[model samples]
Target: MRIGILLHALFYALVLWKGSQASPYWMGLLLGSGAGFYWYGYNLLSLRETDTKLRGEFGSWTGMLSSLATMAAPLLSGFLIASVREIGYPLVFSLSLAFFAWAFLISQRLVTNEESELPAPIFCRRHPNWNRVLLGNFFQGIREGVFVFFASIMVVMATGSEWALGKFTAVNALFSTVSFFAVGKLLRWYWYNESMLIGSFVSTGAIALFLFGQNYRTIMLYGIITAIFTPFFLVPFAARVFHVIDEAHERYEREYVVEREIVLNGGRVLSIIAFISTYRFLPREWIATYLLLVGSMQILAVLILRNVGFRLKKSF
Candidate 1:
């Protein structure tokens, strides 16, 4: 985790010093591994601690806190970059260092955890349901990757400034923070499938709105609505994904976590590769096709959830 943050800070600092003229691309390649390490370190540690700390309900506040960071960080970075390049990147990166340091210090306060021997084989070699979840996670990852790839370009084309991208992101996440916690609460009151179904419907609607968002104003409005709706699906989907691990199989907890991370990361990596491959040659007109793919996959994810809920008679 420390190396991850340090590398990220280094990457941004390099970008700031040399601009794109430097091989920021190579720097980015280095940072990618750092990112993987970051994800593995923080998520792995949190997974170990969640049962002890959050009672496996980390998804609730995790979503809200993520939303808060999403809203605040970009806005701050945007303002810094736009009005104060002298202070922008360093300030933003420094804040990141502070956050990482704080998390490290807090973690130091916890008792050191010990590894234990497994009572049974780590994975559910017999169960098909968890495998199905992995398949769904992959498709969901594609949707997310494509959205991010396009949304940044779309915002730039619409409004010509990276600062505007940050502003757009901040606005998009404003209500997302509310919806994150709300969905968490909603999950407490309803079955996972029920909330997931509602979220899927909303995601479909939001994408349809984006299809018509040709102007920056329309795009910003689309961001708002998308924010309002996204967490309905995402928060529940994340919680239910981890919920597949039988709480009774505490010994297998780490294995389940690492396995799920591998599967989901596979999907994310594939989507990024696919996007890069086409992004180099594809014209902007192809965006419509991408959006269609996302909408179709959203429905497919919902279907998988329904299956898990009804057929498995489990987590959902």
Candidate 2:
């Protein structure tokens, strides 16, 4: 994790020094690799530290903090850019590097005595349920890949201002934070499937609001609705994944993490390619249809999990 953060810091430093001369492809490669390392290590550590009983709470707090950061970072960046036009981007990049360095330093204090072992080869056959979990993760990633970038771009296009998009995202984050808090308090082990079902349906349905118009109001409504329900889906989904990891046995946890990442990224790449193809080779009006197709992916994930008969306990 520290190495990942150091790499992230290095990436920022290179961008800060090179500015526009930097190749976007190489910069993205560096950033993506750093993210891969960070998330892999983070997920392993989280699995080691959390159990099924408490995983929901852990996910909730993590989501809440992430939402807070999402809310603050945009507003801060926008303020800095507006206030200092000449040096704004560089300043933001520098601040990001400093924060990464701080995170690296903080990570150094973490003490883990667990011994590492070689994970089974990626192609080795796994339990049926494990494969289903990976499939669910893949579908989840498909929705995320399209929605994360496309939704934000649409908001900016609709509002004709980055500032408006930032405010919109901030409001969405606030709603998500509240939703996470409520889910943390109210969610129970037996409710996981039901929560995911409701969240998936509502979130998927919210995408239809775009059919009304691609204006700011419709987009904002969509964002708010998705934000409020996403936690309901995501928190349970995460807990269920970890629960499956536990079922697979402690030794295979690392293997499952690697497999999960690969499958998730594969889905993301496929979705992005599909989106690009649709945009380039199809009519503009087809975009909404594409969004609707991808938006329903969460329901697919829920159905996959349901088919696998995920263990639901009466008590946590």
Can you write out model 1's per-residue Cα lDDT over 107-215, one digit (the tens) per residue? 5665655656654544555456677777787677767766765666788898888799998988877788888777666555246666777777776666665566577
What Cα-based lDDT does every candidate model obtain? Answer: 0.68, 0.88
| Candidate 2 local Cα displacement, residue 40, angstroms | 0.4
Q: Which ranges of candidate 2 are over 4 A from the true structure?
A: 114-116, 309-315
Task: Report the alpha-carbon TM-score of model 1 versus the true structure.
Answer: 0.82
Kindly list the per-residue Cα lDDT of model 2 for residues 201-309, writing each as its tens digit: 9999999887778988888899999999999999989888888888877777888888899999998989999999999999988888888999899899999986665
Q: Worst 10-residue stretch by lDDT in candidate 2?
A: 307-316
lDDT of 1 at 203: 66
**212 Cα displacement, candidate 1 (Å):** 3.0
- Which RMSD values do the candidates have, in order? 3.9, 1.5
